[model samples]
Target: MFISFEGIDGSGKSTQARLLAEMLRLQGHDVVLTREPGGSPGAEEIRRLVLEGDPDRWSAETEILLFTAARRDHMERTVLPALAAGKIVITDRFADSTRMYQGLSRGDLRGIVDQLHGLMIGREPDLTFVIDMDPAKGLARAKGRNGHEERFEDFGEGLQSRMREGFLALAREFSGRCRVVDGDRAPEVVAEEIAEIARKSLAWTQKA
Candidate 1:
């Protein structure tokens, strides 16, 4: 199973991803936990350049392309092989972040992102869990984690709102494969809800 967890920064994606992987492992299932833009060495380098550098160094198109570059590498080097080996892959963030960040946040680059996504991930996630949260709440948690904010995370209210809307749009567009979970709840509660959803989805897939 290839499952992805997505949401705005500080939406508890990483925490829930780890928890889901752990639960799957405890069930004697082989599982791999990873994240986008930094899953592989090459992708990690791209991540640093994209997230840590001066904002002006890259245009919206450049950002979309770089993100796609990293994603291509990550898919080739990590995601595909694991799935072929029968290991469940749980990713903290995936192509949706690129669409939301560079496409929606930056505007005018969604076509570029969509083309890259089709080229890279020919098949979308078997199941995508979108952890939805308020922008202010999510950003506050994100800032607390780093004691500072990265360039993308520093977009404040306007951009954050757009990003959240973008996520919802993607979820609606792929409703059959995407499930939005209320992330405003406690972390443990969210994890439990996600696990149940994953369990049910896995069963449904097998029967199909």
Candidate 2:
């Protein structure tokens, strides 16, 4: 089984991803915890190029290509092999992020994003947890970290708001595998909910 955590910056998806991975590992599941743009050596290089620069450093079209390239490398080097070996893969973010950040944040270029995704990286997570949070709150949490990868956070609350909406819309669009979890509660509370859902998913997968 493959799982992905998606949300605006500081929505706690990363923490949730980690928690889920640890929990699953405790249950004797072989789990590979990774993140996009930095899962592989080649992808790690691209991560710095795209994530550490200025927000306007790359155009949306250019970002789409760059992200797709990184994702392809990540899949080839890390994701595919893990899944083939019968491990559960969990990633911090995935192509849904690209579909929002580069596709809708700038202009209506989802077509381009989708085209590239289908051509290069055709796999989607078997389960996706879209951690939902308020835009302003999410931005504040993100900025509080003072991390270097503030390129997207630097885009301001407006972009975060739009991205939040885009993610929610995306959940509806891909409802089959997407689950929206409110992130306003305490971390343990959120993690418990996610773990329960994940356990149910695992049981279903096994029965199938």
Candidate 3:
């Protein structure tokens, strides 16, 4: 099974992804935990270019191209191989992120994103957890990280707010695979919920 965790920055999706991987590993599952824009060597290089520097370093159109290229490299080098080996692949972020960030955040370019996705990266996670959080609080947590990859956070609270809404809408759009999880609770609480859902999904997939 391919699983992904997505949310506004600092919405705890990253932590949740890690927790899920660890929990599954403890249960004797073979799992591969990865993240987009940097999952493979080529994609890692692209990650630095797109994630660092100023918020205006790349326009939405340019970012779409860069992200797509990275995703293609990731799929070819990291994701596809592991899946073929029968390992469950879990990623912190995936194409859903691009659909929200580069597609809708800057402007109304979701159509272009979808077109590029269908042509270049025609895959989606079997299960996606969109951790929902208040934009203002998320921004504060993201900024508190003080990491070099602050380009997106630098976009300010307004962008985060829009992203929260965009992600929720995206969950609705892809209702079959997307699961919206509330992110305001304790980490353990959130992790438990995700683990239970993932456990059920994994069982169902195995039966199928």
lDDT string, candidate 3, 36-118, tens digits: 87899999999999999989999999999999999999999999999999999999999999999999999999999999999
Model 1 lDDT per residue over 1-208, tens place = 9999999988888889999999989988899898888798899889888887555668888888898988888888999999999889998888888888888787678888898789766767889999999999988888777732277776676777888888999999989889999999988899899999999988887798
Model 3: worst 10 consecutive residues (lDDT sum): 35-44
lDDT scores of the candidates, listed in order: 0.86, 0.96, 0.96
Which lDDT tens digits does candidate 2 get at residues 1-208?
9999999998999999999999999999999999987799999999999989788999999999999999999999999999999999999999999999999999999999999999999989999999999999999999999989999999999999999999999999999999999999999999999999999999999999
Error of 1 at 33 (Å): 0.3
Candidate 1: clashing pairs of residues: none
Residue 45 lDDT, candidate 3, scale 0-100: 99
